[model samples]
Target: MPAKRWNELSPRTRKLVVVGATVDAVLRIAALVDLARRPAAEVRGSKRRWVLAVTLLNSVGVVPIAYFLRGRRPQPA
Candidate 1:
């Protein structure tokens, strides 16, 4: 879905989607980080690189949504 669609959603819905995406992004980022720690000999080939690239992209994609959702939270009185 487009980022514009996120803006159209209700704050509650946007928060849920952003939080979910953030968690997903973190998990994928962790996996990518772990892959780097492994020895090159143990790591696979193009498959590993592809996974890392995709994860990086997703991690980047989650940032704006998360930021926008954070701003949507009601301030405590």
Candidate 2:
């Protein structure tokens, strides 16, 4: 299907889209910052691979969420 232009979207649809994009951006940034600060030994897999995946994938928050949930090793109490 053809994509609708921004002006053509209804107010509710536009609002939803904007909110979704904002949330996705926030998640991505948070994930990236955490990845950068955390040591390599604290990460589950290759840091290079995680960087690529987190930066490149447009999973609408899935990739970032995965990075937080499965990528990092738990810190000692």
| Best model number under TM-score | 2
Per-residue CA lDDT of model 1 for 1-77, tens digit only, reads: 54666568899998888898777767566555655554554434443664545455655545334333331234347
Task: Give the alpha-carbon lDDT of every model.
Answer: 0.54, 0.94
Worst 10 residues of 2 by lDDT: 49-58
Q: What TM-score does candidate 2 reach?
A: 0.95
Model 2, 1-77: lDDT tens digits are 99999999999999999999999999999999999999999999998999899889879999889999999999988
Residue pairs in candidate 1 whose N, alpha carbon or C atoms collide under 3 angstroms: none
Per-prediction TM-score, please? 0.47, 0.95
Which portions of model 1 miss their true places by more than 4 Å? 1-4, 40-77
